[model samples]
Target: MISIGHSPDADDLFMYYAIVFGWVGDDLEEKFENQALDIETLNIATIQGIYDVSAISFGAYPFVRENFALLQTGVSFGDGYGPKLIRKKTTQLKKNFRVALSGVHTTNAIIFRLAYPEARIVYKNFLEIESAVISGEVDAGVLIHESILNFDTSLEVEREIWDIWCEKAQEELPLPLGGMALRRSIPLNKAINIESTLTKAVEVAVKNKKILSKMLIERGVIRVDEKELDIYLDLYANKDSISLNDLQKKGINKLFELGFKAGIYDVLLECEDYFIPTGYQALRNS
Candidate 1:
């Protein structure tokens, strides 16, 4: 059995559940066992080489480049919106304000730190960030996943992380959030097969999004209700997520460059160079 680790967020569930439901890859000999954890936990697990395949924050990918190569499918991007930095209404943030972030290794945290170098940061689970801000546990907190959509009225948006991404990007590009990566130790042929299967799984999921969404709601598999889940899926789990198009690949490269320039990475790596070479499968068969 191949182990898979992903966030329990609606987007991750939307992309991965087709495999669980046996709607795709039924002909393959491999069996997939999935574990749902918070994105931060999955990021740490990916760096440790714990799962054969995992969903990881793009910011965390540079550290694990040697052991894991990115998969083309199952990526999340923010076009014009993303994680929100929120604080209690009528409160003004100081330069050294204490803030709660989802995790130290998350993409939002990494970018948030770069944007607010003087801010004091504490790590908390994504679920706790909103409450932390409300209770004065911190001056502000970054809300991710579904929290970005339906935050409490008492809290107000301080800034959007996507704005920071745009300023740093210096060009039009989607904000690269998270993606799937496969362990490089897997044999090339088997790796190719697995990537193909997973790619199809994502495509199938997008094609049958309505059907799958209903199934998830009926089974109580996702945290959000149908309306919230539908909106979240469109933002993060749509057709663009099925594979890395040229633009998305460029976006990932830009993220790596940004991380490298900020001293978060030792080297600047091209994102496409690290993907599993599926073309090799055809060559070997021929």
Candidate 2:
């Protein structure tokens, strides 16, 4: 049996549904068991090597790279958008202003830190971030995931993490947000099979997006209504999600490199070196 861990959020639910709905290889389907948790919880479990395969933040990769290899499929990238920093319309942040971040391991937090090192950060659940900002408990907060979709009118966007990313990246590369990680201790052959299964699952989901999205809403796996769900999925689970492209690999590497330089990681890593060897199948066929 293989255990798969992922977030319960809409994009994750959308991407993994093909496997959950039995659209992949039958044998692989029977062996699969999935666990749904919030992203921060999954990131912690992934670092502990608690699941055979788990979803993780790109920001968390540097810490877990020693034990897990990232899966090339089921990724979320933002081309011109991402997490948003929000504050009351009249609020003006001074240096060292307190900002609420979803989690220290979240991609948004990493970008926020790089952009505003002078700010003081406090961690909170993503669900509670908006309320904290509105309650006057924080000067600003970074809104992530579905929180970015709908927020209180009293709060205005201070800045988008996408803009922060663009300034930091200094080129046209999508921001690498989150993706799957598989335990390296799994024998190499088994790791390759799991990787291929996940890649196929993402492909199936993208091809049957309408049916899957409908099922997701009916099942209450998605929090947003149909219209918002459509928009949210397009943002995070669109074509870029089915597989990682060269540009995304570069983005992921840049994320790790910057994090390492900033002391977020003990060592620098190249993302390509950590992927499962799907090339083995082509070699066998040749």
Q: Compute each candidate's TM-score over C-alphas.
A: 0.98, 0.96
Model 1 score (lDDT) = 0.91
Q: Alpha-carbon error at 147 in model 1, in Å?
A: 0.8
Alpha-carbon shift of residue 170 in model 2 (angstroms):
1.4
Which residue pairs in candidate 2 have backbone atoms (N, alpha carbon, C) closer than 3 angstroms, thus clashing? Answer: none
Segments in model 1 whose C-alpha atoms lie over 4 Å from true places:
none
lDDT of 2 at 152: 95
- Local error of candidate 2 at residue 119 (angstroms): 1.4
Per candidate, the number of residue pairs that clash is 0, 0
Instruction: Estimate the TM-score for candidate 1.
Output: 0.98
Query: RMSD in angstroms, all models?
Result: 0.9, 1.4
